[model samples]
Target: MRIVRRVFVPTLVVVVAVIVGSGIAGGREAFGGAAVGGGLTLAFLGASPGLLDPVAKASPVASLPVALGFFTVKAVAAVAVLMLLLGDDGRGPQLSSRAVAAAMIITALTWVTLHFRALRRVRTPIYDLG
Candidate 1:
């Protein structure tokens, strides 16, 4: 139960936010397709061995740009999810306006919780000295 509350629920919230947001912002076709594609790409990249060998071999200076690029893509995906949720309702699920509004509100609250948790962690530092 504790794990469900602390981990599963939060994860679910983020996922719902991403999916609904993407669907709404990009319309059904573009946003949904992008979401699917992005998930597959991430999975493939993560599963593939030696995919990061070149980056690992690169100097820190050379790898910095790659790291930045990776983060940028993630940020873009996050924005895309939000934008998609708030954008036109293309040939996707015809959720009522009220439902969409509710979903937006829920997503916002979820994000707030996530941010709050991160802030709490930052503010209350814990040190582990082995």
Candidate 2:
């Protein structure tokens, strides 16, 4: 929970900043694209720990496979989003794909960086006598 909070706060700040910047640069379409990208990424990142932690605690051995499956799902979903935003077929509503991509990259970097920092600060005992 502590790590989640640590990562979520800064990531959200980055998301909002990117969305605002997109809006200023490319107007409503861009803003909407950025919002969608940021929101999806945030949902994926935010749900990871909350959803997986219980599985991990229940069966550490099973956690790895479950995590891998979860990641695969996220990856596929991201690709689907990129396809939708690309809108290269001339059949869907247009959006600034660049804005969406940018927001996703920036927010993802923030998430990874904050997670690393939080993990580094963790103090775990190597041995428990009790």
Candidate 3:
């Protein structure tokens, strides 16, 4: 929870950049990107720092499997939730299929970029042979 604010400060820049870009290209897409990207990425960021907290005990190589399994499950569940919520014509987004697609792309990019940066910066012992 303490890290959420710090982590998100950087992402706010991305949200604004995407919003401005998407707004010029498409208003609804901008809105959808902000809503979904902002919401989901923040949620992901909030959970992720802690999800990999245990990985601090492991080497980067050892952390891969844990990280992979963690994200695969999260991705599958996210898809399932979206499937139930969004209709064929993207009824839930209040915009269009295009906007929903924008949102998904925005969320994914934001998550991946930030998470990779976090992983790089995560603290680990200098010499943990395991």
Candidate 4:
């Protein structure tokens, strides 16, 4: 349990970092597209309990449904991006490049917070174990 809790948040941070880096290099459209796709994938995996079992069982048809689900979600997210970009005027608080950068920084800080929490949880003795 400790291992799972320790690794899960850091893994999420790593994934967010990868997505942000890819977006920075590939431009806004590419980054947005990738974010939509990756977010759907992650959300699907997190929500669906049996989705991965078929893949592990090597059952292609069973895997098809999960794949379709993720694809549908990604498509919806992409459409959402299109709607936001096309419909919104330059008025409200927009998500600029700077916002994306700040979000990435916040994600890193989240990882640091998790690390500190884990460190605090570790038991320390007056005498050294070694």
Specify the highest-TM-score model's number.
2
Q: lDDT of each structure?
A: 0.48, 0.84, 0.62, 0.53
How many clashing pairs per prediction, in order? 6, 0, 0, 0
lDDT for model 3, please.
0.62
Candidate number achieving the greatest lDDT relative to the actual structure? 2
Per-residue CA lDDT of model 2 for 23-77, tens digit only, reads: 9999988898789779888887888898689999999999999999998998898
Q: What residue pairs are clashing in model 1?
A: 21-85, 24-84, 25-83, 25-84, 25-85, 26-84
When sorted by lDDT, best at the front, the candidate numbers are: 2, 3, 4, 1
TM-score of 1: 0.30
Question: How far is 65's C-alpha from truth in model 3 (Å)?
Answer: 5.1
Residue pairs with backbone atoms closer than 3 Å in model 4 (clashes): none
Every model's TM-score: 0.30, 0.87, 0.55, 0.34
Of candidate 1, the 10-residue stretch with the lowest lDDT total is 42-51
Candidate 2 error regions (>4 Å): 88-92
For model 3, residues 32-57, the per-residue Cα lDDT tens digits are 64466455555655566577766846
How does model 2 fare in lDDT?
Answer: 0.84
Better of 1 and 4 by lDDT: 4
Off by over 4 Å in 4: 1-7, 49-130
Please provide, for model 1 over 2-113, each residue's C-alpha lDDT reduced to its tens digit, 9 standing for 90 to 100: 2224533564545455666667775655445445434433332332223234675766566667766765775676456545653465323433334334444444455456
Pull out the clashing pairs in model 2.
none
- How far residue 109's Cα lies from its native spot in candidate 4, in Å, is 24
Q: Rank the candidates by TM-score, best first.
A: 2, 3, 4, 1
lDDT measured at residue 112 in model 3 versus the true structure, 0 to 100? 71
